[model samples]
Target chain A: MAHITVTVDGTSYKGEVEPRKLLVHWLREDIGRVGTVVGCDTSNCGACTVLLNGRSVKSCSVLAVQADGSEVTTIQGLSDGNEWHPVQTAFKECHGLQCGYCTPGMVMATVDLLSENPTPSEQEIREGLEGNLCRCTGYHNIVKSVSYAADLMSAGPTKGAK
Target chain B: MIPVEFDYVKVTTIDQAIAALKAGGEDSKIISGGQSLVPVLRLRMAEPSVLVDCGAIDEMLGVREDGGSITIGAATTHHAVMSNPLVQKHALLLAQATATVADPAIRHRGTTGGALAHADPAGDVPAAALALDASFTIAGPGGRRTVAAKDFFLDYFTTAVGPDEILVSFSIPKCDWGSHYAKFNRTAQAWAIVGVAAVVNVEGGVIKEARIGLTNMAPTAVRASTVEAALVGASSAADITAAAMHAADGTRATSDLHAKADYREHLARVITARAVRAASGI
Candidate 1:
């Protein structure tokens, strides 16, 4: 077992993890960050996507030990108190999800995407979220949510809908 | 899908990585970004006894100018490589191909060296590296050695890198040639059904020099020398299309779920023509 210190959302957690432990499993089973769900255990589905050191990555494809000393931001840490993040607000406003199984990953991926490209085109948003998969096939509104989130973010933090 | 338990060793230097690999024995595997390796581990395809994490190795983490060539650290992520100005200016084919790998999230965590060392025939970067004439720098107990891109990929999921050796970086020669990677895939994140990496130097509407690399055409990425030779002095799309007909001359394409060997061969011809036309601006 290897001891690792990782900061999730804003809380730092220290644990002894087996070398084989995936970051997604550690986040869900060990620390109770179940917001990051595992869809396809394989890396194809980005249901376990999270921010690793401010960049998006599939947590299932990263070892817990590899994430040692790194900061991870999951879907659980997106809002501040009662106020939702612009991405979260946009998803709700635009009805980005149906079954909601892929919402967390979709929202987190949008945050990362908008961070890089503040104002992406429709094609760019489609290409940006290619890693994520929604079995419900609700991509039309998801793309709408991303574009709306871009608008919300660009309008300033104060403009987020309650 | 939890992987089998194994010992993990994180190293910050190439020498330390070499020592850890030596201590871990032949079953040990070196992991950088863990994009490919972790997936294999979860699938239980590879059960290494020890995993030497080279992600923190300082020497293997950035792109630098090395005279006429640019040296990209083995651990440099695909995102970094694609956006790197040096790589864009020197080896645009690599940047173009790296941009198409997996997706934004995968690119964030996947490293160029990791993809090259993993040596998946369906991967996009190996063919780009071959087209760019990139050379891999590997470090072992006996010291360091450089292997050309043409000779680096030995077989499917295999490389010239030995068990005790760590792939340090890749040195790619600078070239001011038009390049394009024509990739055909069924889905957004799926592996290339067939990919053609083309780099051509055109002068006065005539091809002066050209290099072509085929992906998923064989057990490893191979150069389309016949097509390359046929494309020289050609001034039109017809010439390029005719030249691309020989793309499957020496390729060992295989039948798979995505495409039959013959279909892949046909793709090789069609995609090679498109890539060459775009690369040469015909």
Candidate 2:
């Protein structure tokens, strides 16, 4: 076991992690933050997306030991623990997901995307979410969800929580 | 899948990193950014005893200019390369090609030196570097030595570098010639099945010079010598197109799950023509 200190979503947690513990596994298994799901152990499926020090990365590709001393924000960290994040709200409002297996990662990717590009074209949205794959919902509604999230965050009061 | 048990040590300086690599010797590997090495480790494609993390080395994480060539630290991320004003204004081929790797997230962490060191023939940066005639500065126990880009890549996934040597920086010359990079792939974020990087100097309606580099059509990123030879004095669109068609002649393209060799050869010509036209400003 190796000692590591990671700041996730705002709080600091220190623990002894295995050298092989992936960041996604640490978030979902050890910390019990199941909101960050793991789909494919491989990096292809972006089901374990998270914000690492502000930029979005596949949590599955990030090692927990490598993530030491970094700030990570997952789907569970989006809101103030009371209401849904703007992107999450948009995802729910626009009916973005079907099976919901890839929703958390998609929502996180959307959150990072809208933050970087406040106003994105339809093609930009498509390219932005290319890393996150969704088998269901056909991505038509998911694109709408990202656009709606952009509008809500850019024009509404839920901006400070991100 | 969890990687097999291995001891990980994060080294801070180049000397320390090199020392660690030598300590572990054949059983160790240097990981900078982990964009490529991490995936390989996860797939069990490579397993080493010690991972010398070069990501934290401050000396290997910057971009600067010495005299004529712009020197980039080995650990500088692709995002940094794309955003750097020096690289954008001078080595735009490097910047442009770096942006097309995987996606924005991967770019944020992937390093230019790592990609070339990893030596994936289908990757965009290596071919661009080859077209621009970049030189690599490698550091080892003996001292520092510079290797030209053409001589650096030996084969598919093989470089001229020895085990004890570490690639410290790449020096790219500022070519005033027009350049363009084009990759033909199946999806928005996939490896290039076939691609071309063209650097041309169009002087008074005459093709004064042209350097054409091909990707995914051979064992390594290669120069289209036949096409380049045919293009020296030809300026007309038709002549250039005809010359560009020979980009894949006398070559062997490895057919994989992505596309067939003939299809890659076909796409090579197509992308080469587009690259030539774009670079020619026609």
Candidate 3:
């Protein structure tokens, strides 16, 4: 077993993980961050996407030990508890999900995308979220949510805590 | 899916990594980004007894210029390669191809060396590397050696990198040629069914030299030498199209679910023509 110290959702957690333990599994099982769900462990469906040191990556494709000295932000940690993240609020407002299985990953990917390209064209938004898949084929709404989220974020900081 | 348990070791330097690889022997796997290795492990495709995490190895990272060549650390992430000024200015083909690799998340985690060492023919970087004539620098207990990109990839998912050797970096000669990577994939984040990377060195509105790299059109990334031979000193679009017609000559393309051999061969010619035309600015 390998010992790892990682900060998730602003809280540091220390644990002994097997070498083969994936970051998605470690986050869900050890760190109790179930918000980052593992949909397709093959890295195709980016359902386990999370912020690793402010950059988004599929947790299923990363070993827990690789993230030992890194800071992780999951879906549950996207907001300050009082208000929803801009992407989350946009998803709700734009009806960006159906069945909601891939919503967390979609929202997280949008946050990373908008952070990089504050204002993206329709094609850019679609291309940006290509990694994250929605089986419901609700991409039309998901793209809308990203556009709405870009607007929300560009409007300035959220009403709640940073 | 869960991977088989394995002993893990983290190395901070190339020497330490080589030492671990030597100690672990053939049963060990060196993981840089874990983007490719982890997926295979989860699928039980490979069950290595040990995993040497070289992610923190400071010696094997970054992109820098050495005279007229750009030496990219094997551990440099695809995102870094895409954003590096030297790469964008000197070798834009790499940047163009790297942009088409998977999506944003994978780009942030996947490394250039891992992609080359993994040696997936469908990977965008290998074809780009071949077209750009990049040399892979490998280090082992026996010390360091450089292998040309053309000779680095041996077969499907295999490379010239030995079990005890780590691909340290890739050195590519700088080129001021117009380059483009045209990929045809079924869906977003899908591997290229058939792709072409073209680099054209044009002078006085005439093609002086042409290098074409084919992906997923053979057992390994193969160069369209026949087409290249036909393209030198060619200027007109008709000349390029006629030359690109020979793109699949002397190739051992195979058929898969994504496409048939004939279809891939056809795509080789068509995409090669398109890539050459765009690259030569005609």
lDDT tens per residue, model 1, B155-198: 99899999899899999999889999999999989999999999
Clashing pairs in 2: none
* Whole-structure CA lDDT of model 3: 0.91
- Candidates by DockQ, descending order: 1, 3, 2
User: How would you encode candidate 1's per-residue C-alpha lDDT over A1-162 as one tens digit per residue?
Assistant: 889999999999999999899999999999999999999989988999999999999999999989999999999998998889999999999999999988988998999999999999999999999999998855999999999999999999886757
Q: Which candidate would rank higher by DockQ, 2 or 3?
A: 3
Lowest-scoring 10 consecutive residues by lDDT in candidate 3 chain A? A153-162
Report the C-alpha lDDT of model 2 over A1-162, residue by residue, as the tens digit.
Answer: 889999988989998887767898999887888999989877766888899998888888777888889999998898876767888888888899999999988988887888789999999999888878888887999999999888888787755342
Instruction: Work out the iRMS of candidate 1.
Output: 0.6
Which 10 residues in a row give candidate 1 chain B its minimum summed lDDT?
Answer: B1-10
Structure candidate 1, residue pairs in collision? none
- Relative to the true structure, candidate 3 reaches a TM of 0.98
Q: What is the lDDT of residue B76 in candidate 2?
A: 95
Q: Estimate, for each residue in A73-161, the C-alpha lDDT of model 3 and write its tens digit.
A: 99999886677888888898889999899988998899999989999999999999999999995599999988998888888775323
Cα-based lDDT at residue A84, candidate 1: 91
**How much of the real interface does each model capture, measured as fnat?**
0.98, 0.44, 0.94
